[model samples]
Target: MGRIPCCEKDNVKRGQWTPEEDNKLSSYIAQHGTRNWRLIPKHAGLQRCGKSCRLRWTNYLRPDLKHGQFSDSEEHTIVKLHSVVGNRWSLIAAQLPGRTDNDVKNHWNTKLKKKLSGMGIDPVTHKPFSHLMAEIATTLAPPQVAHLAEAALGCFKDEMLHLLTKKRVNFQFQQSNVAPVNTTHDEKDDTVEIIKLNLSRAIQEPDMLPSSKPWDFTGATSANFAGACNAFPGSITGFQYGPSSFGNEGAKSPWSQSMCTGSTCTAGEQQGRLQEKLEDENGGESEGGKEIRNGSSIFNTDCVLWDLPSDDLMNPIV
Candidate 1:
């Protein structure tokens, strides 16, 4: 009797409630309200333990309880919330209007878990089951296609920084010139001349290539993108804007390997720095000033150079 177990007293009932007992508990709670569990059973004239009374009232006899099968949207919500919160049944139940925690847990264990497993998804991680993917593609994805993913990810980085920085007066600018790539061979004698002109004389800049923008990074983040090295890639061509990159044909920049080194893109950080610089220069935050400052950036090159990258960074594999 000292510890609470919903049935500690010798005189208290232990089995399921009969119709008569249910009525007594329900009717009493209907008028008296739900509070003070220890006092409820005594006041209701029930032979059940105090905690037993509370459980019966909350789980079964509660007037607002939701009943019947869950809807399609409800099921989806459960799966999605479980992925985010993970086994926190109370929190999950709160999101579901009238469903109880015990009900939500039971549904997940019996139905949703099986459903995800059958579809080759691990219910726990909400990702594809490893056995479903027996072999991963071993051959390197074409560098051109893969670089686009990197660029998309880079844009995502920039977008995220802009959000986090709260529109601080800052700017992002980039320019790059393409030079040729030399294989793992000795440095070519004609590397410097290529850098002096845009990509060994006349490769037109692609529409997707990033243009030099003064204070607004919105241009680079847009979807209409086709890129040459004036934006991204590394260690191939004499391109020095986005990163060190190789080109299909042209004189190799001597510093291709050492041209641009970054573990992760710093374009987003550049936004933060520029905001501070502009604000300090103008004596306050500049929402969208057309200061027209064009130069190299953390992820770009200085000077107007249309540096093209290796063909691998632009084309797709067959």
Candidate 2:
């Protein structure tokens, strides 16, 4: 059987509700309530279809309709709900007292999605942008080091998620009061010398690095580590910091040059040289700095490293 149309297209009015039509619809519904929309338009002398009347009443004519700008709390609730329910805008709207499904959908497309993207979050997946980029980067890694790349990428993702959700991450390195190195010094100066020592130690035994996990970056090679560092400019999680701890000038650390060039020195030789430099600079390690031997400390300072997991990168509600 062929389906019947709800109303005759020739006879019914279309586009834009008039004051008379609004008053007619409102008066009819007020008098007898919306028991039958199809019958109400006819009884109210409105040339509009039942669906049109229904939309007009529900979206605009309703006495309880919220017709102002959406509040911040309301916008947040909509975004949080949308993350879980996705494009099921009607369901999301149901949770919000005054919003309609169309309103919610429009707001998400026009406003909220851009806001999330600006924060480096995918609006649909609710995942960090850097995390997604890292996943793609790991696939290009050599098979022998693929697992290491995956682990390192996972750590990076977790760090991004932690930063997005928790607002702050704890690590000795991140919290330490190391003075920013003067970047204007000669390339062979003490600052550059210290950066080389710290970079070699960081690359050789990332497992010993104090972070969210001790061995999160265990098998990462110097080349891959340097690439990761370059890929994320300021912070491990791709967050921006005023000054980089590796050197004063953010990603332009002196050690990055050595790593990028693939230094020929073995890990043992690098470690030895790094230790000598550290001793020379500090005039011997402090009693509290014993952790440096185990690779638990770098840059001759107590500091924390940022790391993250692959799953649940953002809080479900945020």
Candidate 3:
């Protein structure tokens, strides 16, 4: 027969702590501080277990524990971090200053984990769910894992191609929208209510700029700026893509409407050029606007018209 279970019938103290017990434990910790939880009950003159005392101090009474709503940045950081670290909340907490392991754990389980899963990211592996799962089965799974692995592999293969194709299409669309921009000058003689028709037009069209495809990092993370605390070997590095691969688009993303929902390049280029000329007259200086005007910026002296409303748009002299 198996040996008798330890403490099965032992009269061990358990359950909630009393007010008197709290007072005693609090006073003892405040004076002596807890060195060993197993000896805490004996030293503090309480019947409660050492584990109970430790939990009470760490979870409830710890002075540094911040019990409040997490800020937006904090929430974002937590979601990003969880994507890399998996469910190791204690390790995750170590990186987040003023955050408790229990709080971080609850936030992940109740909010971030579910949100990422909804966005097609596997909370456990922190990648396109299919990609992460397939990689896992490939590395550690047995021969029997084939049947179970096929679905994930097929899904990721299709999605990867689809996303890549979509990005290419977006880039093509943006390139096709480039147009010629021009500015017109007018001379006025306000004293006699007369206008001269001798005007000059200068074309300011920006060179054809390359497109930067967008990344599909819809998944929430645990940490935003910092690296993951528990990043393991072969962990899906930096969310979906490698860290070195991230590049910011110049103002407009390739997939955004500004790139995709436009006419052919020649037509768009003309309209964009015309728009830039008008915007320049009205003092517009966005990078896209600058591109349309063939000028680097609206404030650039190369194309700025000294007359008309252009001066009103420039910053006043100090």
Best model per lDDT: 2
> RMSDs, each prediction?
23.6, 22.0, 26.4
Q: What is the lDDT of residue 123 in candidate 2?
A: 73
Which residue window of length 10 is worst by lDDT in model 1?
A: 129-138
Tens-digit per-residue lDDT, 231-253, candidate 3 = 11122223332111121343232
Better of 2 and 3 by lDDT: 2
Estimated TM-score per prediction?
0.41, 0.47, 0.40
- Please provide, for model 1 over 1-318, each residue's C-alpha lDDT reduced to its tens digit, 9 standing for 90 to 100: 475554448988878999999999999988898777777787888999888888887677877788888755456556655654568776556555567878899999988775554332446765332211111211224454344434433433333233223333121213433343342223222222222122211122232333342112234432212111222212111222111211222345322322222222223443344333323333353347634333422223431111223221111110
Lowest summed lDDT across 10 adjacent residues in model 3 is found at 195-204
Candidate 2 lDDT tens digits, 176-269? 2333322333522432333233333334434333334221233433443333332221324333211232224445543222111222222344
**Top-TM-score candidate index:** 2
- Candidate 2, residue 35: Cα displacement in angstroms equals 2.0
> Clash totals for all models, in order?
15, 9, 21
- Candidate 1, residue 92: the lDDT equals 58
lDDT of candidate 3 at residue 18, scale 0 to 100: 76
For candidate 3, the TM-score is 0.40
